[model samples]
Target chain A: MILRLGADFLVAVLFSLWAGRPGWPGFVIGLAIGFVIVSTSDLAFGRPNHGRRLLWMIHFAGYFLAILIRANLQIAREILTPGFNQTPRIVRYPVQDLDDLQVTVLANCITLTPGTLVVDASEDGRWLYVHCMYAEDRAKAVNGLQKLDDRLRREVFSW
Target chain B: MDTVRDVITVILLGSGLSFMLIGAWGVVRLPDAYHRLHASSKCSTLGLFGMLAGAVVYIGTVDALIKAALTLLFTVVATPVGSHILAKAAHSRGLRQWDHTLSDELADDQRDGPPQV
Candidate 1:
């Protein structure tokens, strides 16, 4: 506990210097609370590979936004057009990054997109159960997500 | 000496407040959850860091400064993870997304590799 505080304080100092703001009281208070909260959670849950996990997570997050924004724009267009045919169907899209966390992320991205909903997700790392909305080209809709995986692999994971 | 510190402190406080406000705005204005996370996480951390810097300067101690700095770093490190988890959980829960998702990562996973993380 002593060590934890010490370590937290040390980290707080470093971060403050880097951020370059002034005022001691709020900084100290907030830092202490943050440290305690994070440590408690870390202790309760086994320490994950913070370095690699964080790396992957950050990249995942970055791409996730790009994909999400694009998806929203596409949907708006579909909605405004009277001829828009919202033919939603369940399809199997193959998934990788065998980590359960990664798979879950992918599944959710699919469901979130407009005109589509993930009907079922049970492929045993072989394929993902995906539903598409107005897929003019089945291959195209499935192909779009590949860039996210590539970005994640290149930026976050080596393989 | 005191005057210098006071000026620095005020500046820090002002900047910190701005960041917090910006983050709040982002939370509301951003198009979707993912965008909101980007603005809030990135901006909130920046704001927190700014506030901490002010604290360090006011205290005028290397120890205090170091502690403040650590807070910034840890927050930077931790926030993305939290955001990632939230995003993933949101996605799985079937939140609606933009339609123009180009270069589907999952499709690539199907052909040559795995899915998006």
Candidate 2:
């Protein structure tokens, strides 16, 4: 908890610095904003799971950024190249283990990533129908989704 | 040092514009709605992010930096949700996928009957 609060404080300090307040005023404002951030996150995301949650969140953010960049490059290549290499398909991706929030994150991440979009979900919420822009091999596409699921399950939703 | 910052900003802005151009081209050239969504949403998200980043670097002002950062953050978070809702609505409305589409398990499952769960 202390570490998480400290991290939030650091982020708030950076924000204050960016906002042109430096030195003592910035520190004071950072302290206040940091407390608000910590409390608000607790209220929104439920209680933190030890100090590890922050580390996992940082890891997730890095991974998400990497994937976002890769997704864009892949799309750009497709757009610039000659003939279509796409073999699009809508595949059912099971998400029975994930709760509502986890599922929501997964869906959004899938949509944001390379060559995949979340088109729909099953009535029971057990499955997400993803449209893959390149599904030349079905298992390969499903495995990509599974890797993302594992990452989320291992990192963000471990609690 | 000023020259270095200007160069970096120019590169960022140029790449951003090119990405936006590619996104527009994709939208026009792609065969169907889902493919176009794939193009427009992802590319434009990154393109706007790059442009905002360039703005932050070029402006070199605290207020502009904060505003650009917030804009980028909100764009990153919101774009995917918007595309997801659009894709779902299109699917539910029976908007046809490209004829060459390899498979559609959603339609197959629906055709099979009510969802098992």
Best by TM-score: 2
Minimal lDDT window, size 10, model 1 chain B: B101-110
TM-score of each: 0.42, 0.83
The docking category that best describes candidate 1 is: incorrect
Model 1, residue A146: distance off in Å is: 17
RMSD of 1: 12.0
* Real contacts recovered, all predictions: 0.00, 0.74
Model 2: how far residue B101 lies from native, Å: 0.7
DockQ of each: 0.05, 0.65
Give lDDT tens digits, candidate 1, residues A1-159. Answer: 334456666666555665675456556755766576656666677764333554566777776545544554454444334553454434556664457766655554544443444444444665665545555677766665565556655654452
Highest DockQ scorer: 2
lDDT of 2 by residue, A25-123 (tens): 676688677767776787788885444676787899899878988998999898888878799999998888778888888998898889999888888
Worst 10 residues of 2 chain B by lDDT: B108-117
Query: Cα-based RMSD of the predictions, in order?
Result: 12.0, 4.7
Residue A80 of model 2 has an lDDT of 87
lDDT (C-alpha, whole model) for all candidates: 0.58, 0.85
